[model samples]
Target: MGRDTSSAMVEHLDFFQSFDDVKVYYDNGQNIVKQALDRSVGKVLSKVVVRRRKTSMAGYRLEQVADYLSTIELALVKYEAKEDGETYNKFFGGIGSFKRNWLKQARCKRI
Candidate 1:
């Protein structure tokens, strides 16, 4: 991650601040992440704890949930862009249903 993405993460510092402690788990590239965070949010670094995990071998339940949510969000973006219509339509039952159903429910759980 570069300063740009790290800068984006800094924008969410308030979310991190809400929790007493924040733990970030990554599958790889710990060094890059650390560097990014160091440059972007170094002052609040003490509140965050970063860990490296081989998710493929031993993944946490939250990680699975995160993956699911991200996949759905990506699908929504692709649908809006009018890309991969067939697959999204088959799974989500068309754009109207996808928005009224999936996206609505997902947004309710947004943090």
Candidate 2:
């Protein structure tokens, strides 16, 4: 089954609650994202702005950084589960190095 979009959106918004304002950019699923944003409640709704942009046309460096962070997070998950380590290894050398170099630093900047 597909993931629950509404719940996912709420969780993501919750993660950024400390921020005074948030601007979200996505390449697809604009309708789903907008509907989720509309349904959201609390102070976070006031802080968030969702914008749709084609990835190819997105010249923002933040967009690329977000994508890289997301990929690293997914790779970490897969690595821990023993499902996939190729990506983690290719980019980070090994699990020890991944945790020491990337994971620690990434956690500090997590949104």
Estimate every model's Cα lDDT from 0 to 1: 0.71, 0.65
The sequence of per-residue lDDT tens digits that candidate 1 reaches over residues 79-102 is 878894787888998888998998
The sequence of per-residue lDDT tens digits that candidate 2 reaches over residues 1-111 is: 013644565579667766765555545457766555544532335434543344553567778788878877987887799876576588787878888888788888966
Task: Point out the worst 10-residue segment of candidate 1 by lDDT.
Answer: 46-55
TM for every model, in the order presented, reads: 0.47, 0.44
lDDT of model 1 at residue 93? 82
Best by TM-score: 1
Clashes of each: 0, 0
